[model samples]
Target: MTAPDETQAIRLSKRLAADLGCSRREAELYIEGGWVQVDGRLAEEPGLRVRPDQQVQLQSGARAEEAPPVTLLLHKPPGYEAGLGGIEPGAHASRSRGAPEALTLLQPDSLHAEGGPPVRVLQRHFRQLQCHTPLPTEASGLVVYTQDRRMARRLAEDIETLEQECIVQVTGRIADGGLQRLCHGLEFNGRALPPIKVSWQSEQRLRFALKGIRPGQVPAMCAAVGLSVVALKRLRIGRVALAPLAEGQWRYLRPWERF
Candidate 1:
């Protein structure tokens, strides 16, 4: 797949501003304060080019003067694109006009109100928060957006390797041994797929746990096994799960939470 233009040789401060929704001055301040890093190394230069392969991140323990980065876990409902604009390659590129901004889902009341640590809502938290995980426009599930460059880089670089668990609701009957095929007999982009764990969540729902999944891969795998997908929902990504947060609502990723 072709890399997005934004990922190639862009100035670090510009990238930060674009990703975090802050001004260039703010981005410069963050970088100069040693709050920003490129590929795990501290970057003091705002003009540094953020190569496509290099990851950009902010220190988890930034000082009070630095705008605290925020990582949000959103229960993305169908119809909204994950990112501000379609920056990720291969995913859908356009969002319907009048579609709600997924960030709006992050309201004061939506904060995980049960038992976890309480997170403050700040105006800056809503600004420039970039989506790390891009869900298809039709799919509904947990979506992650963050201002911390480090978390963003980690999720983006590890996306293909990180295990994602999805629940797929299907129609039609599965051919005998189809379950086994789903677990082992799939390929994408003309390459044999890595071994995956697939099992029946229920009569019509199939639970898939796999790494290196690409866009539209699940439906293709289902069709290869004589099943038709009716609905699909991602339930987990790495150690994070979509629970407690209801659809169209969002909550903060606690300081202790990873991925």
Candidate 2:
């Protein structure tokens, strides 16, 4: 039997990413973020495994980019949780093995069940994307995933580093240069965020493109501008636009889709 064909276990990492159909960087992120599991045990190192038959999986907190190789141009309503839980416009919260899932600021339904998978399904799949956003857990619009690290990093930087675009409805009379101030005079947590492009779509309707936003910076910027945001929605991320999706819907990214 030649020593059972010399079956050997392999360490996981970039190689594992190719084997598992995720990005190398994502695999590392998953491991570092404590999302790796082997043979029903938490495996911290990507290179630690015993056999091909051993179970490999991810944890809940690490599986945000579930639902396969997807790119959603979500219409992100005002109150849906930005994470795996929430209620407003997206998917419904999937009940845990029995624990009611986790507590979320928004209703626990919008984050999991729409065109996307149930939170439990996502949590069961890949927890691999790095550089997660720390929003209110009730934020909405454009999320991406892939088995390609190169594409993922490019998308991440293009969306977060370049000017991100959004449409907001404001209230109250405008102070002079309020939009101008928000476009260029914004700062958060002491670091200077990137400048933005702001203009009026109509009275009470504003269109903005800002870079280096800190999660909920738009709302904060509105508050600073003394403008009450009656409604806020993300329309684009870099070159990816929300034009094709209806509320609560998602789709796989095209092979030709570039940042």
| Per-residue alpha-carbon lDDT of candidate 1 for residues 1-259, written as tens digits (9 for 90 to 100) | 9765763588899988887888898888778666887988888778888876778887876542654787888888877766633322124456657766777777667766662534445555676788867776667788888888999899878877778888889998999899998888778779898788999979999998888776567888888888998877778888998998778877778888776
Provide the lowest-lDDT 10-residue window in model 2: 99-108
RMSD (Å) per prediction: 14.1, 12.7
Model 2 Cα lDDT, one tens digit per residue, 122-149: 3222334332221233445654434456
The best candidate by lDDT is 1
Candidate 1, residue 41: CA error in Å? 41
| Best-matching candidate per TM-score | 1
What is the TM-score of each predicted model, taking all chains together?
A: 0.69, 0.50
RMSD of 1: 14.1
Backbone clash pairs in model 1 (N, Cα, C under 3 Å; residues 3+ apart or in different chains), count: 4
lDDT of every predicted structure (CA atoms): 0.76, 0.54
